[model samples]
Target chain A: MIELYESQRAMRNMRRAAMQRGVVAILDVGSSKIACLVLRFDGSDPSDENIGSLAGQSGFRVIGAATTRSRGVKFGEISSMGETERAIRTAVQAAQKMAGIRVDHVIACFSGAGPRSYGLAGTVDVMGVTVDEQDVARVLSACDVPDFGHGREVLHAQPVNFALDHRSGLSDPRGQIGNELACDMHMLTVDAQAIQNIAHCVKRCDLELAGLASSSYAAGVAALVEDEQELGAACIDMGGGSTGVSIFMKKHMIFSDAVRMGGDHVTSDISMGLQVPTATAERIKTFYGGVVATGMDDREMIEKGGETGDWEHDRRTVSRAELIGIMRPRVEEILEEVRACLDAAGFDHLPSQQIVLTGGASQIPGLDGLASRILGHQVRLGRPLRVHGLPQAATGPGFAGAVGLSLFAAHPQDEWWDFEIPVDKYPARSFKRAVQWFRDNW
Target chain B: MQPLSRKSQSARHDPAPSRLKYRFERLKLTPGFRFCIRVVLPFALSVGAVSLWFASDDNRLAFNQMISEVRETVESRPEFQVKLMAVDGATSIVAEDIRKILPVDFPVSSFDLDLGKMHETVVALSAVRDATVRVRQGGILQVEVVERVPKVLRRGDRGLELLDETGAFVRLANARADYAKLPVIAGDGAHDAVKEALALYAVTGPLKARLRGFERMGARRWDVVLDHGQRILLPETKAVRALERTIAMDQAIQMLGRDLTVVDLRLTQRPTIRMGEDAVQAMRSSNTIKAGGE
Candidate 1:
């Protein structure tokens, strides 16, 4: 049952096993930081009526957490492979030491390249009044596995919708009475090599690869409010190495995209423009970065330290207006590129007008006004929601994706799990009927 | 129950021993089997015939008696009626007009009343797909039918017609219904092409209801119009997707205002708009020529 869905099977089984055994570990392998959290599933009450929250029955409890600054990674890719392997080992070791458990299976989340989308449709026939496991298997088998691009393999092909006879847009069509059942699935794919790289990193850390998630999608799960998710919303996560954009509708991520530049670029701009060290530039950005400048800022000056160890050079100062003039353009360009991406996504057609900005870069002062100007909508800064035992330090926008990954690992979206596998094919083709597809798949 | 009598006992077992005796007696009649049996068998058969009688055609075989009674009732008159002329492919044509078109095909005779063969003959014509002709009790024949409607009106090398979603071509000239609404597709090989022009209209539920025509711009794209005068431009790769995006965007931007003239989804994410006179002018130039032509 656990191995039925090709992508998330192991993770689902591991999560279930952890719940039965009372512990699970979640790992987030991001460019800026590597995060780990040990969760304890309290499934005695899976029903939400006792929880008093709109968020569906969340039965997981986090016991221990640790995050280490990531090293040996550049542009969200493994540049120094050995250094990356060592970094992952250090993060997992430190997390294990704190949790007091030798965790085996770890669900990982990462930001990188080679993200693609495909639409696959499968059909199955209903032979009786009540749709059984065989019916579910048949419809899943009938899906037309599209010819995804060469050199790329599918990572996630989950059924997004189901149709029964003349009725369509059914989220679940299992119990309905109809002669035919069809499903339209949206599948996400990534570069095979990128997946293998992450898998290798996890395997070297003495942990099994339970699952993988796009960084943008995980952050959206943590950042977006319920209404925003239902009507449609975009999450712009400005991480240290990359800025990820994910669009959600009907509480599911329909599109996930990332730009290769983010908060680090802003720090680099400040370092180059002010002729200061990288550390000092980061401080200045944290204290005084602004996309919009005030009239009084021209007279106001910030004390800048010189590169050398000379007292006279350390006394240098630059006007705040000058810093704004230097920083505003780069921020504007990033927003313009984001606008281009949104236009590419055809964002103007969404039903709502809300945009949530989260991440290290999004924390900069006046970035909201700048984003609203460029994205052309209502914009707000997003912070990670409070979950059981989430550390105060790990609750910031920078840790949104990591925290969301923890929650996601604990209670994943049950996508293709209910689709009982037929005897014939794991990825069923469109030509087979439901029962025959199930027979062939199983 | 009465006690068994001698006659009753004989009646119960009468045929059993006789059947055995009959088989045994046949063994002794070798010479008589050919000559004597032939003479005895005819006499036995005549005796058997006199005991049984059978009726044929029930009591209705007395029609000869009824014909003599009918002969005294009315004066004789020659059978006369108007002729029916049916045009090929006009399966739904009325029978009264057949006399006006070709007045020599129908004749007033009881033998000529079977119109099934004639109906089949007309339906065999290239212009006719199906038809039905029936004769009434008053000697007047009436016809009612349903004709095949052309699916698509195609124009490229020469004017050819299409039927159904199969994209099959109809060769007959002027066989299409008068008020039937069919799209005119134009391109190099668009005679039977099932591309974006057809798909864009097929997906959008509300838009499909008001579709007026489609103009194929080569094999790649389409520009279409709704009956209420809304125009749409669809892309090649994800035509259905582009349509869905357009619908979502329309709800968001309220771009499909009552005065909207054109909605374009060709540019990946950007929706180009044309309104007022420019939209009307563009629509007229693109859709006017090939739309309602005969």
Candidate 2:
């Protein structure tokens, strides 16, 4: 194995060890919720061939998970450090209790802060008949590293696929005889400070940092199938504080985007329309929110206690039609924005014909029909895939990233190790996260 | 008597040096040595100053020359001669209308000519299938690219640009390439998988010389074809190994010499072969039954 590859594998193995002892945690610090899953990994002998290839590839099983309502976060930014830390701790402890283990290593995901995408291309001639690992590294380094803004940094810069002369879409060009090799890579950039803030919050919870992924990307991994990923498909994860969209093709995410409006906005709309408290409106929306109202729905009404302490004016009923009327327009608006994002991503231009909807807000009644109409394509409600030993509480769309992070941890995509990192003969630290912990720690 | 007495006294005492002798040893620095040191110090200092001035001037000139050489070399290279194709801060520039960006004496020689880069750029055009880039001795870089002509245009909310196995996506604004018989990838991820299948096809080599179309079954695996639609189902895993096995089977059985469809290799060990429509229906039916029993 190459030196860099070995080192990365060692690091991953260390993470695997920490996760396997029933103490690995995943922290999803989003605008809407701070979810923590303390997963107890069931270890199989790494050298055992049967275990190594249980599913023709690597696999993992999850044992515990938990989530908590977030505070001090607004659209993915940590405004109050102490409050966020408390939320993270609460979620982690709850998950640990459920798993019956103590967790120390955590992999976290975050959404919002306006992620941007860029396309970079590179090429190199194969010195030998077969493309070797060195050739792959050389071509990747040959790609012009784009200049993101001063404070922003590249989080994920991956060679989605490669093409040989006259042939395209080669996943691993190595060991194939080719005179020349070229690669089209998708790069994602985010605010460096935002990443540090998330890491800091997790650190405050006393958990070791294992890895980090964009929330939208994690959702795409769990929601999209191999076929949808191989061709072209878009995943729209609508959470409470933000709606994230990720585009996948060739089993890799090519584009990721997000809008700062989600389930919370719909709840706010319901509260305003019904003239009820925000809490009551939330309960009503979850129970009876609808995008399309029928004649039967118009006659049906519900009773609610008024705020005024007058028993005589206590009960009032609003038709379900009225509720649908208020919710449909807002849902339509969110979908329209999502459609715009897809258009901006040039989604239709891709060979993609399928659209998957996930996340907490995605489960709303009649959302699929509304999304299909607005998105102008086939839309399906996506649920997180089944993994071994997942608790029933974690089966909701709200747990998508937490569950997917578990899967990603089990079967990781090719990282820097899968190929070699071109050494300017310098240490990997040159490329490490510059802002180590949040500047606020000072 | 005095000399003998002094010798006896010295041997008896084995005495330490007297104060006068100790003082003489302490003040060993003499005027002659001091005069020589004082004269040499000023002369050495003057010589050093003169040499430092000349050395600094020479160093400055050398630095200037190196910078100019690097600048000249970089300026001479053609815009696309470098594999990176970096138009630094020139996002507004169009790749097609880049004639003006080409440097006059671009050093095509120094530029590493990677055919793969040219192939990738061409494949990205959605028009090209097979791309070949070559640099002659005279420093002329020639690109001969064959494009995947769209057989059917897929209409969605946004206009679609589809390429065959190579993932070439041509914008709607761009002129369509001449190869129109190539089938387009329709579903999501289809375009990318088609490219993967094509790449896997390259490994097929001699067998690819007999292939017709490669279709991706959306989220499922590939359904490959030989001349006139002979389908081969490649399993999701061990794809490369399966391709190798298929080639071996082709050579051993001379299957490529005949018309066939649905060569199922989903099972790693057992390879199923379905004869093409050109074969006698009765015979094909009999073959399926016989193979099933086996």
Candidate 3:
């Protein structure tokens, strides 16, 4: 954990260096596609009262964007190292070309790897009259880190809440007088192997791993509006191979979990149930995929075509109702898993439990109605927040993770490792004074 | 049966640039690397190549030869050739002296002629006050000159050299009789006081028949000698004013015509006269006769 803390601190330093350079690249390794966006931090006027500025106070603009079909990636985790590296190269190179500038630092995100969240609380007496940055760091270090099992890496550890004595829910408690300083932190851990694979691929590409974030948390940051995040909302990013569930409260992610099933499962179901090729089944699913079958669907027939030699095998027809029947259960299963995750995270206890579904798979027709029915009465389809110079084609729900990664690069949430570990036994003032006396005499 | 997604999926080319090419493209995008490639590299390469090529002795010689050859052809153009020398605003003698001192040949290229040095040489002659040498149109090396006309002839060690108004030597005369129109001054350092000598000579216009020349005695004061071996001594400072005072005395009292040997005006407060031998004798005889008669 200490080693990871050092490395994370090093990465934060690299992020600062990249910010000084004014250019950084964001990579989202998703199950369906690998998206790369080059963000240019122009360090624009901070005093300008322009609310519509890109990424708010951090004026970063997306100068170049490119996406390529992902290969050797499963459930949003790199499965085959070489192929995934190739795909990443394809996307990054195209984006670099479009941007006309080379980017040396990359902040990457992934959604799979079974991310697990832990809430930690720690308290310490204020070192002086008022709480200082050192005291805050000491309190954070005082938090007892869980074992989290072996071969697991901490992805994100953010202080979700702060309390100075009786005052709770304090976003910033520094310079506030208090006898006791306590902090509630949200920490997410994923498989270390997944992180290693990503780091290795990025190393092969000759890029510095400046930072890493969970795709689910990133998507929540992008999809949930300011009000929803302030009140409380759950963003269910229904990706191709997985559906990520994240709950944001007071502008911070409180809980995040991912179901291992998504739109791919629905396509597989259609392929298996309709006795058709996966490609044809995928086409049919996109054209007529839905969770709620109607009476008029039975009359609409879809040609699940193939080029097989057998004439009967080449031509296969199924009604739209049957296609919906095949896809509806799979979608419902994914949503149910998300609901279970929310329930486990105590989503009902939040002040406002708004559920927003967004991702590549969230584009399913009538999914909002179906999600509302299955998950909660409040459900809406979500898209990524618009940013400067983002292509119109990449502004859909599918690009939530990529867009969110850009925002993360521009303005990253502070993590536990961002602070220094204050040395316990520092030299006393008397010793320094003695040295000063010697220097004066000499 | 046709698969609807075939068109979209067909011919999917995975465009992963090679490692070298990808890195090269990135290097091209880097501001430092791009600057090296687009600006520094090209400049350095050209400079290196040129320096390398010219490092060879034969090549250096050839390059220098080429340059000189081009310069020679331009210099030898007919329009640049100065065919003749023309000296104006000078006497024939000064012109001859200018031609003798200048080291140039006719039909020579003007580029090979150093006009500034030629003008300095021409102006070096005492007769020429100033000269400007320029290659004029119609292929002429024209030396425009301003010659100093001698104001007074000084009989010095150089034997009657002509001096201009500022006491600058212009030329020498065979004898003082040749320049009778000019006042003759003879002294150890008389050229330096030509202006005063000339002014004194002009004041003697009334007694021009009796005025001989000025002798600069002890190189401090002037003594104007007349036809009868009589002289008027002048003070060093304001000699011209002293000479004018003497001329007024002469005009009023015929002072120079009397039997007086010298009129000394060296001390402005005192005017003294020395009698001639004849005048002294006559005065002595009259004194004896008057005594006897008394």
lDDT of 3 by residue, A189-234 (tens): 9999999999999999999999999999999999989899999999
Residue A160 shift from truth in candidate 2, angstroms: 0.7
Candidate 3 C-alpha error for residue B267, in Å: 3.1
Q: List chain B TM-scores, each candidate.
A: 0.38, 0.39, 0.90
Cα lDDT tens digits for candidate 2, B1-294: 124454554334322223344233223333444455687777888889867865797777887898989977885666434332332211222334222323324444444455566546644543444555555434565555454543333222465554433454543423223334343334455555665565565676776556555556655676666666666788987777787777887889877567676678999889887776657686867898989964
Q: Per-prediction TM-score, please?
A: 0.55, 0.54, 0.87
TM-score of the candidate numbered 3?
0.87
DockQ-based CAPRI category assigned to the predicted complex of candidate 1? incorrect
Q: How big is the positional error of residue B191 in model 3, measured in Å on the Cα after superposition?
A: 0.9
Best-fitting candidate, scored by TM-score: 3
lDDT at A74 for candidate 1?
A: 61
* RMSD per model, one decimal: 50.3, 52.2, 5.4
- Write the residue-wise lDDT of candidate 1 on B46-129 in tens digits: 877744422434334455456755653332223324244334334344233333332344455535445766666545543345
The better candidate by lDDT, 1 or 2, is 2
Residue-level lDDT of model 1, residues A1-442, one tens digit each, is: 2343544666567656766766667777677777787776666554536444636536776666877767656656665555567666666655655665556667777766656666678877786686766677777777776676666655556676778887987877878788888887766777767777877876755567777778788888888887898888999888877788888877777776778887778889989999889879988988988888999889988988875888878998889899888888888877787777778887789988678999778888889999998898589999876777777777889878877887677657756654566645544554445656565578
Q: Give DockQ for candidates 1 onward, in order.
A: 0.00, 0.00, 0.54
**Model 3 chain A poorest ten-residue lDDT run:** A420-429
